[model samples]
Target: MAFEPLKGLRVLDLTSVVVGPVCTARLALYGAEIIKLESPEGDLMRGLGGQSPTGRHSGTYLHLNRAKRNICCNLKLPDARKIIARLLETCDIVVANMRPQALARLGLDHETVTRAYPGTIYCLITGYGLDGPYSGFPTYDSVIQAAAGIPGLVAARDGEPRYVPMVMCDHVVGEIAASSIMAALVERSNTGKGTFIEVPMFETMANFVMQEHLAQHSFVPPVGPAGDQRLLSADNRPVRTKDGWIAFTVNTDKQVQAFLDATGKGDLKADPRFATVRARADNVRAWFAL
Candidate 1:
């Protein structure tokens, strides 16, 4: 048997690049009929890399757009707009990543879609949120990382701010957008009305930082630095072994004692500084050095 919950759901995906496409791809994997609408030149990701002439098989693109149907349309033209309006008339969901103003100019925004098709669920993904000061300003993964202070949080202890590499900001935002859409769908089911959602990558990541890492530092006295309890450690990456690497962690006192016993250093567990969680936190550098 196959696992697909969103079967029979029609998702019209007008997203390009990593963030937006990743969200719709999740829907596709759940057996939704994902109609990926591309521009006449096709999604720029098609020609992003590789030695092939068409460059249609970008590993990055293939990773996200596997179950979607490719459809090319010149959205700048009136004929293309007409075609989309017709499709939206019957489609259950419409997802796009265009900027807020640009979406309004094209008459493809949530308000327009709601008036035309009251039962359609329209979701828009943006670099920043739909409102606020930096709403219209352009942004990408790295830019969002810098703006969100994630890079600074992950930086070296005594070195300059460092980025968390791999465009994870966009990646996380995509997941949040997908989950938000599904939640909205659930509400629509109960109320028998359509819904509109605006998912801003920066806004989402900002909240993520607040909930996961900023909890302790949200006060003025400053319980501690604004960072993850584990990953933000200066030496949190792969550990060097006699041969290669082994990423290992002994988090709790019991696990720490296990490693200490194996290494014949269990006696240190009873020392004053290594006594409790607060002590361990206070002397983390010495603990890590040991």
Candidate 2:
């Protein structure tokens, strides 16, 4: 027998595209019963990432939606709302990635769903938070990456702004939302109450990038500036060896000394700038050149 942690849990997944579906797919792998609610026209991803032999399910859709049952419903119709209400009565969780207004219009927003079914964990994944200027603005992986300053980071490294080839923002946010849902379920076990979770792609990705890059700007008066110098250095990549290339890092004093000795640069360990973490960070380019 398989270890099915969520074997008895039921999830009504009204999420399309990468973020929401990816989250539910992970839950389904843990043995949750996922009912993937789709529109009559089907998920847009069904036409994306190459066609199948039958031309019905795209490769991307097949991979992301495995181990889940799909159902088609026209959310614009009143009958569909009735069907959703019936599902909510028995579901342990409800996940959606629609814009806040669209969810509100369909009576599937966190407040509305919690009101109807007090014990359902309502997870709403949005491009932005429910309020503020960009709340209702449409967003995708590339848009979120650009808005979160990822392209700027790339520009700093390569002298040009570029979207990462993969849907990095979507994948990161989806995995985070999945873990958050599991945490919520654990909390509900103790409190006997469900929670409303809002995972905003813009804010989440911004925090993800800035945590390492904030560097000196994290201080009250701003010690120097935002962005870690070492990370922004154009030379911060794999070094070419005689045969090929290798990636390595020497952070601590012991590691640095070992690296310097191995590279026949043991004399450089005596240099003040190469002696400590703070000193090396203060003169990162020189340290890299060394």
Candidate 3:
């Protein structure tokens, strides 16, 4: 208990996939006593990756759930409900990512948890924000990526906006959720009260990404859409070697100059229209082409 920042903390974790599981896993890593509540079928990630430390657990599941105790409970059963309620009574936090309706059915909703354990920090992870036309609609990572206009971003340069190579939005939202819960825990320490926090993945990702789209609001004169010209270059990809891909982004002027020098195009440094940040941002395609 003395070793962990949250050593004495007790977490009732009922989450799956990349976002919620990673949040609880981070808590457990820091010495929180995290009890992972799971269905009979177990976490869907158990079968996501073929390889594992042991043959039984998949790579995805192992990475998502480390240093946490697993408890199999089918919330559909009355006995399971009693068990969950008991756990809630002693827990400091309960992190769940189920749909609002499903959580209500299992009596794991905010009202139920607060009624049973008023001091428990109840964190809800949903795809969309609590109030919206799309709230309560079941969504996954790929679906959100498609809806978030990322596909359009990808399609901007010859190809259509494509799915990001990884489960980045999910992981990003999970980190945001974990950070929020930790903040709430700190607040609780001072106030002797826990708070209900919602970390909607879609909202979180959208918020995280909207900065790239803030062209009109950020500048005095509105730029056309939020399209970043430097990022628009078709060469904005990993350079491939004989064996594998070496990924890097050329964002800063110094970095671009370095690349130009390395590629024997040092004359670009003297070019007036390519020297300034805004100029580079505006004419990145032609600059790179030259």
Candidate with best TM-score: 1
Ranking by TM-score: 1, 2, 3
Write down the RMSD of candidate 3 (Cα, Å).
2.8
- What would the TM-scores of all predictions be? 0.92, 0.90, 0.88
* Residue pairs with backbone atoms closer than 3 Å in model 1 (clashes): none
Q: Can you write out model 2's per-residue Cα lDDT over 1-290, one digit (the tens) per residue?
A: 88789999999999998988889999998999999999989999999978999999899999899999888999899998899889889999999998888888888888999997889899999888888988888799999999988888888778999998999999999988999999999999999999999999999898889855688899989998678888888888899989999999989999999999999999998999999998998999888876
RMSD of each: 2.0, 2.1, 2.8
Cα-based lDDT at residue 187, candidate 3: 96
What overall lDDT goes with each candidate model?
0.81, 0.91, 0.82
Question: Which candidate gets the maximum lDDT versus the true structure?
Answer: 2
| Residue 211 in model 3: lDDT | 64
Candidate 2 segments exceeding 4 Å error = 1-3
User: What is the per-residue lDDT of model 1 for residues 1-290, given as tens digits with 9 covering 90 to 100?
Assistant: 77888898898898898888999999888788899998777776776656245655677788878899888888889999989888787688888887878878988888988898998888888887777888778788899888888766766353677777687887898888888888988998999888888888887888877755574678888887665454555665677879999878787778887888987898997987777777877777777777
